[model samples]
Target: MTSKKSITRRLTLLFVTASSVVLLALGFVIASSVGKHFEEQDMEVLTGKMALAGHTLEQLKSQNDLERITHLLDNSLVGHHGLEVLILRPNHEVIFATPNANFPIELVSVSAAQNSRRPITWTQGEQTFRGIAAELPTGISERSRVIVAVALDIAHHQAFMRSFLQTLWIFVAGAAALTGFLGWAAARRGLAPLRALREQAQVVTAQQLSHRLSVESAPVELAELAHSLNEMLARLEEAFHRLSDFSSDIAHELRTPVSNLMTQTQVALSRQRSADDYRSILESNSEEFEHMARMISDMLLLAKAENGLVVPTREAVDLAAEVLALFDYYDAVTEEKRLNLALEGNAEVSADRLMLRRALGNLLSNAVRHSAANTTVYVRISASLDAVSICMENTGDGIAQEYLERVFDRFFRVDPSRQRSSEGTGLGLAITKSIVLAHGGTISVESIDGTTTFTIILPRAP
Candidate 1:
């Protein structure tokens, strides 16, 4: 496979190629125009010279005046270098010729009538020539016809054009090279912002996720990139903080039970004890073990839920039946707290039966634990065309505004001191949330006017 090229090199090559093509095209056009211009100029000169020679022939009074005509031709041809003149008689014998003139005989043979001219081009050795031939009327006799030829050398003009084209090619190549260099330089300069972004990104780590790209200072084209990178950094930073907090909370929660078990075991083994005492110590240790086991189980369940490993079997679950079952389970605790439990309204939701039951049990348990004495804990279910909603409200000292949002977070509690009278692991609400989410539902909590309400909404069965 071939390696990819950089944008700078690509742009530079593009610029050079385009410039070279344009320059070559322009050169061809100019060269053709110049060649045509020279041909036209030479043709005009040759035509005039032919006309002059014909007029001189017409002015001759008789055939005996040929000498005067020759003299006139020689005088007219003076000071005109590279110009050749020749006069032929009716029998094609040269009658007059300029000194050193070597006009082609073929030019005289291809003759035109009097007052008419024909132009022709021929080359001799290294010299190219353009000329015109015309038949002239000699006044000496009716049978005396004179053919006049006038030619101009074009070798110098052809040489000039060759030199011009060579120079033009050299200039075009130089301009293309210079343009390529400039294009590369401009591309590099324009990409400074991207380079800066890369450098900034290189410095970022898990510990330094707070650093953000300066979007406002970036070029308009790169501003969106910078903003998106900054937003990603913000999310990574929040996730990092959450990970750190999760680690700390897990350590704290586990340490309590483990430490308690260790201290109690050490106390029991401090001296010889009766079988009842040993059994009682073992039972106490068993409670702490159970608590730690519950915490670990809840953590595993949450992890599986979050990773989409928990696939719930959907079924029609009656909300009232689930609430009644939970009330039965928590009857002893509610009776001790003198809290009354009430279930109102009925709805069926599309959910996993076991998962829904567990979620409602957790919510009811939490409400009963927090409700004031003799206060009623209410479970209200409602249904719409497409969804079912369950609201669990309990009368108590409501949660603080700040803690309401995080009440469903794992191990979070409104009580900052974490003091608990019940055998709760602080994962009840968190488990409820995970179960609800696994069933394609949402759970939210709000506390107002000495009342805390937990709401769960699930899609209705089709």
Candidate 2:
């Protein structure tokens, strides 16, 4: 696997590369411009000297005037150091030449033939010169035009340019290093908020899930990520709290039944009871065991549902029919309590038959158990375009406002003082919620004016 570079290092490298490219480009332009300037200055001096030589040759009337022309040319060269001039006839015979300044024969021949004024550079031994050549007319009609070449030594300029280039590259290297350091520092400072967020997250454990990352202090680009992380932490904290509560509730629920069984057995064993008395105690103990078995089964079902393992078998289930069936099943209890079962409206939903029946049964049982005598337990079904709603409302002491959200939580009860040995396991509402969710539905509750309402919404049949 390829190792990834840190943001700081990547940014620094990019900065260095960009700066180096720009600096090198500027340096190249500068070097080229400076070299051209030196060539231009040298060409100016060489051209001027050639012009003077041409003027002297133009004054030549005959062979007699040649000596005076050469003398005048030699005198004109005076204090012009590092300058050389060569004049040649059409026969390639030298008319005048600088002593010991032997310009190359090839350069003279090529420049004379081309008659170009553009400067050319050539090196001789330890010296470099820029020179130009032109054809000039003589005063004598019998003689042909003369070729005049002029050169200027540019060794000092070359030396200066070489040093300048060396200094420029060194400066660019140093600048790139400095820019890289500054870029790394800037990148590190820019990412400081992420480090802080990570540090805050690192301290978060199951026990410390309540810790939240600050979104306000984060950079705009990372603000959304921080907000999402905070939301996740909030969910984790709530889940952890629920898990803690579930652990305590399960232990408490199981302890009572086990303690009852143990106490009953101990009392029965201590005193030799008759066969009927022993049988009665065993029968009573069986009830507690059955209750425990039901609670454990409900918890297992809830666990399966939570893990998305409860795949409901899809079928069309009638809401009114299920409620009527549950009412008949609980007829004795409802009749004994003198409570009325009033169901209105009818809707159909596509759901698992047994699961749907179980959910409705749990809600109806709760409604019956909690309803005040002579008050009606209402089951209302309503249908919309895409969904069906079934509401179970009971006339009883309503649940508190704070507990509405947690009512469907496992083992949660409106009355904490309610005995664990109550007829139904506390997991009924939780199981109902899980079943409804398994069928891709939602369950909600609201209490108002001494009436408690539990609503289940499922997708309507296609």
Candidate 3:
């Protein structure tokens, strides 16, 4: 593939091309005007000479005056260096001619045929001339009319024009070169902001994603680009931090159950145990294995949800009915804690039934585990023109304000000092948020006055 030219080179080339064209046009106009002016000056001189020659021809009374007239015309042109004259009778016989003047014969033929005084140009050997010819009436009886042709030598005009053209061409060439250099410099200076932006972007890596381009310092044309790049960098930095935290959380979560298994196995191997003792140890290890399995499964589900791989099968689902089903599943736990389950309102939504149930189940289980005994757990569902709202409120010692925003982060616990429990994995709220998001819904939590409420908004069935 052929390499493309840089912007600076392209701009410089275009500027030079345009400037050269304008300069050439101006030069042509100047040269043509000057040449025409020289012609006009020569024609004025030629016209005056023709009038003089005509006046001299009119003085003729007979053939006798012709000889004196010839002498008079010759003396009249004595001081003129490049002027020539010719006079002829009606019979085409030359009455007088300048010595070695060598005027073109075609000039006489055209002038006589047209009988015009308009100036014409012709070349004789190395000399160019502008001249005019006309028929004049004379006082002689038999020779009543004569041809008076006057010519001017224009060798000086030609020499000056040649010199002017050479100088014009030289100036145009120099100007083009100077303009090209200036254009390249201007292009380079104008693109300095883009170069700076590129340098800033180049310094960004996984470890240094916090670098941002300066939008305020950028040129107006590149300001939007710089701002967008800054936004992208911010997102990358955030994602990197989240990934780091996720990896650390996974390690922390797995270490507990693994340590328990190892400790139990070591204790069992330290002695020869009876069948009942071995059976008890194996059962306890099985519970730990089950907890690990559940944690791993939840992590995988969250991953799939984050990457948009969790596509839901849509159907019409009743939010109230799903809440009732969850209450039934947790009936034993509620009775054991002396807690009451209550629901209000009812709305239908288009969602994946299983995913929606799981999301609600996670919220319900969390509410049941955290609620105070003899308190009420309420589920409310409402519908609008476009959406359905499901809010789960439970009475408890409530989450603190500071930890509200991070409730949906994986493996995050409000009380970090608490030991890991088999009652639940910390991934419930995170997985619930992901599932709600997959169904084109939003979830948020608020805690106040010893009550914690988790509200979910899903699009309503059409």
Candidate 4:
């Protein structure tokens, strides 16, 4: 909660402080210098008049005339001078004043005697004056009859400074506003290219992977950013292209082997042979063909998911039933691996039924293949109205912490030897992750010591 006045006040403080300091400093120096200069000049003129008056009195002593001194004094007070001259007798009698008006006589008498140093006093007219009094060196009056008073007016210099301050205020305010506006406008204009880049980035989709940031007509700094972004997009496009080609290549590689195995299995079943001979070949060939089919399908799905072609068809599904069904489907594999399978209580969720089933089947198969003999693998489902979570826990050699998150990446294998599971094809977890995400779910795996768990959480239907 800040007001505009506070903001404006803060901004003005620096200039205002500087201006006040400068103006006050100048005013002090000017007033001091002008007063000193005026005093010196006036003192010289007053001392000269005193000398002339003393000479006039000395000359008047030769003639012994009072009219001569009176006439000389009367003519001296004729014009409007910057300095006013007043003569007072020892009895405080006003003898003569230059441009005679009732200027306070005691002010002159008391101020001069009390403090001979220059006294700067202000009068009722709001004007500055300096006052001084000295005894005239005249020999005509023996009783020290005259106090020579000089008052210098200082209003013009004061008025000049006040007018300067008014003009300075206008200049400072106008400059601050003009500079602030120019700064704000320049900032907005300079950031225009970045705003354009953001708007263009909003429409970039996977299908339009070739789209790049525009560099033309951009500032040098923003142009560099544009070039870097374009390079990143090019790399991403290349990676996607290679992935698409690899998916096709994998399908071609597995389809021939699978087709031959399927054909041989069918031919053996069709011919008349002993049940055990046909059964052995049929089982061996069927397993090989089935493995090939599973690998091919997972690879295809991984490709489709990367291209964002798979959208989840969400519906309310009974998780307990789906687990039981997958258990039946892989019952032969589980028995062959010497592993026990178990399912937990019923859990209902909103998810893609087929995708969830495939993801579950992959997790179960991986768990079964990795687990030791006599160990149990559990498929558990927990649910509420808002969300459902499925966890498959198994007793297997757990993965390292570093490779846990990366296990869901396509074709990534933790085994440096690449010999632990050749039939895996490395796309199981990848496809599972893609499917879960399509249903607005998250999948993660955690392993500790010798237990690994793959957990999936999805939105549950009301």
Evaluated against the true structure, the overall lDDT of model 1 is 0.83
lDDT of 2 at 177: 92
Write one digit per residue (lDDT tens) for candidate 3, span 79-109: 8888988887766678888885666666676
Instruction: Supply the global lDDT for candidate 3.
Output: 0.88
Predicted structure with the largest lDDT when compared to the true one: 3
What does candidate 4's lDDT look like per residue over 89-125, in tens digits? 6678766666623356777777656646455354746
TM-score against native, each model: 0.75, 0.80, 0.80, 0.43
| Runs of candidate 3 exceeding 4 Å displacement | 46-80, 84-124, 130-151, 266-283, 304-316, 335-339, 417-419, 438-440, 459-462
Lowest summed-lDDT stretch of 10 residues in model 3? 100-109
**Candidate 1 on 144-188: residue-level lDDT in tens?**
777778888888998999899999999999999999999889889
Candidate 2, residue 394: Cα displacement in angstroms equals: 4.3
The backbone clash count of each candidate, in order, is 0, 0, 0, 0
Q: 11-79, model 2: which lDDT tens digit per residue? A: 889989998999999999999999889888887788789888888888888877875676888899999
By TM-score, the better pick of 1 and 2 is 2
TM-score, predicted candidate 4 vs. hidden true structure:
0.43
- Model 2's TM-score against the true structure: 0.80
How much does candidate 3 score in TM-score?
A: 0.80
Q: List the candidate numbers ranked by TM-score, top first.
A: 2, 3, 1, 4
Stretch of 10 with least lDDT, candidate 4 = 59-68
Error of 3 at 23 (Å): 3.1
